[model samples]
Target: MPNFKLTISDIKGKSVSKELKDSDANPLLGLQLGNETDASIVGLSGKLKLTGGSDKSGVPMRNDVHGSARKKILLSKGVGLQDAETGQRKRKLMRGNTVSEEIYQVNCKFNGELPVEAPAEETTEEKAEEKKE
Candidate 1:
């Protein structure tokens, strides 16, 4: 059950989209191909810009959120399936769904966050030069 087309871009770009189908085995939907995630526009608040889906051996689990600003996410269905006619392929029961469950289509976006760097404060002349060594 893979048919997701979720897009949410906020940071001034203002964007919103949603479509989902679940089978419940969530491996981040095998996130692949030009992947980027930090989704959370379902109700709007913070976090938008992401991607991930297609891992029934259909390949495309290219995870690359090299930058994280995840504002909470949780989806399921993508660990194993494909053998409706001896197509052979199984091994995904971390929770359930698999007797014939192969439907994936995820398109995502929720642009924002992941660029944090603020932790450098030592100005007492370097703390008295480390207490004069």
Candidate 2:
């Protein structure tokens, strides 16, 4: 499939955007943050700032308070293990070592109601104007 930027938005119409470089396979080449040898933070999620006024009084809303997880792939290149058969030199590869999941919480509303859909109907004066037109 095509790789496109993700623009996460909230109920108040505030949003945060993120773009990923085009890749042949996965498209979204996961960002290998921090030290590679230490651990691989794969699918960690976070929040972003919004542009409009605060959703809750003076408190601003966070756009992308998402959740994610991480996994351990192969061992570091230099952190080599003994060669089982060759006995010369080699590095052992380990599959999934450990996976970590994380969720970012933020203050925001996700109701499915729009501003135009106000519960109170238009006044009689407004309706009269419409009828006259």
Candidate 3:
């Protein structure tokens, strides 16, 4: 029973965030990075590829890792390591590619057109009030 924050991105570089409760998130469990799933589970009509995610402790997932557990690996340049100098390597903590209950945020890439949500229309009364000002 894990709640997850889904960050869905499109080809245009735009992203949308959606929330998934325990029930809705069940289908996403055990999924690893680079795996594709049906977006219909999230109320979308395209396929979504698992890019990456972070655990509750803010540990980022790395594709090279095999399981859902967290590990401290020697990373020179990758998902969990940042600002590495030339030929620099350090032991950093990172989560595995698999999605687990401890994962808080899930990153996904959409494969098709992302529907744009229209903004709410202003009521006649509200428009009249705005014109009066």
Please give each candidate's TM-score: 0.23, 0.18, 0.91
Tell me the tens digit of each residue's lDDT in model 1 across 49-71: 33444324443332332222221
Error of 3 at 65 (Å): 1.1
- Angstrom error of the Cα, residue 62, model 2: value is 28
lDDT of 3: 0.93
> Among all windows of ten consecutive residues in candidate 1, which has the lowest summed lDDT?
65-74
Best by lDDT: 3
Q: lDDT of each prediction vs. the true structure?
A: 0.40, 0.28, 0.93
Q: Return the candidate ranking by lDDT, descending.
A: 3, 1, 2
The Cα error of candidate 2 at residue 110, in Å, is 8.3
Mind giving the per-residue lDDT tens digits that candidate 2 earns over 60-113?
Answer: 212221212222223323222333344344433221111111111111222232
Please state every model's RMSD to the true fold in angstroms. 14.5, 18.6, 1.8
